[model samples]
Target: MQEAAGAAGEISEFAGPSEEEELQRQARAVAQPDETEALNWTMKKFRFPLERLLNYRRSRLAGEQARLEKLLAEQAGLEQRRAALEREERMVNESLRRLPVISSEQLAAIASFRRFAASEAVRLAAEIHAAAGRVAAQRDAVLSARREVEVLEKLRERRLHDWRREVDQETERQTAELVVARWALSRESG
Candidate 1:
């Protein structure tokens, strides 16, 4: 009976070391940093502020996009008007070309017709010119709005990148601190 008890004690001591070794391995595994910690740090550092900025930028972009769309629509309308005016001008020129050569009496009547046609042509030309101006103005407005949105987007991207970099740097620092703490704890335990 005494021999059996002694043998049991020896086995228990051997088991203890193995149990301790397994515990140490588990501790080492737990001490290793995970990607989740880095992601958490980034979110904590940047998400709130970035969200605020993003909201403001989104609102501004929405407004600008709407304005640009409206301007483009106006430009399309103006272009259609200008095209119609050009077609009318072409038809008028063709009619003038096809008209018969006139005698003196016919000349007076033809002169009055020519004068009236010239006045109509001038009026159509003015309308076309005005439509062209409006189209150009609307196009420029849309372009300007687009440029503004692009600039804001670039700024937002830069801000997000800066925030991400800061979070990454902080995560690296925390990881180093965690490693040192784990090393000290292990040494103390040993």
Candidate 2:
């Protein structure tokens, strides 16, 4: 339960400031008209505070994907090697069947080759199994890393959206103020 709470806390921290916090900040700004006047109603650039963390997560995800690619390559190589071994074994068997008057020495040599091929086949099978296992584990690791990156990306997108909304509201407020000032000026001068 403690671990779950800790995880939740971590996720919330990544989620950026709460709406209440944003409202409090806006209230403070409204209470201080001097600060707003000094800025001339220019919108500040949107900057995500956790940009570095997001970059780090993206790099980690890239590394995990690279590892997965390497594991897959290794698995493919093992499979190709096993296929080559099977082809050689089939060729040897075909040659033996064609030999009608084979001498004892030839028979012994053929048997030795067959035994070696069988042992090698077993070894290759074991290697292929191990390689497949490694590939599967690496795939899982890549998936985990991808998920982390996606979470951060989603948070970043959400924050950007909020910033845009705030900018729009500020723009509307400034427009209304300007329209009111223009109307008052026309009424007095006319």
Candidate 3:
């Protein structure tokens, strides 16, 4: 267990979000207004290097989500238009089927109207298809942004835990050394 702990400490040093890095991160936070406010108000006692990255990632994720929502809204509009066009086409086709033996000019006018409705329906269907594709792509982008933020957050948590462990281990080591030295001094005096 002791060997494992020592090895873990050594690994943490190499994998470092080291104490100096944490201090530098806090120092840099002085330049950011948001960070300064959070520093002043929050319960957090220290800053980590990943804090800046996390903030940037969070903003990026928000932007991605907003983009996705906009694309979805546009897609919904296209879908509504397509449905309306299809309904109009059906109504026109039904009217043409019922109006038997009308004047040649009247029949030609109804046929022209039906053709226009079909053309519009085709155009809207194409637009809806393209908009659906864009929405899918935007959704993927949102998911990617979320994944990036989540990874950074998890990394920050791990680094914080390692830092705390390092601090506790150092405190324990110092206390043990002090106790051993005191024991030696008392034994020699005795």
- TM-scores, all models, native as reference: 0.50, 0.77, 0.60
lDDT of 2 at 96: 81
lDDT of 2: 0.84
For candidate 1, report its TM-score.
0.50
Q: For model 3, what is the error of residue 78's alpha carbon versus the real structure, in angstroms, after optimal superposition?
A: 0.9
Model 3 regions lying over 4 Å from their true place: 1-44, 95-101, 170-190
Candidate closer to the true structure by TM-score (higher is better), 1 or 2: 2
Cα lDDT of model 2 by residue, 1-190, tens digit: 9999999999999998898667555544444446657577778999999999999999999999988898889889888988998898889888888988889998899889889888988998999899888888888988898999899999999999999999999889877765665565555447
**Model 3 residue 148 CA deviation in Å:** 1.8
User: How many backbone overlaps does candidate 1 show?
Assistant: 0
Tens digit of per-residue lDDT, candidate 1, span 1-190: 9999999999988775686577666556547647885566554644444556556666766776676576667556655765665676577567768878646875686577668667766775676577667667666765776666567677777887988898789778877867875885588588
TM-score of 3: 0.60
Instruction: Report the number of the highest-lDDT candidate.
Output: 2
If candidate 1 were superposed on the true structure by all CA atoms, what would the RMSD be?
8.9
lDDT of each: 0.68, 0.84, 0.77
Please give, for residues 28-136, the per-residue lDDT of candidate 3 as tens digits. Answer: 4433336566555433344688788899999999999998889889889888887887787778777767886678898788779778877887887888889889889
The candidate, 1 or 3, that scores higher on TM-score is 3
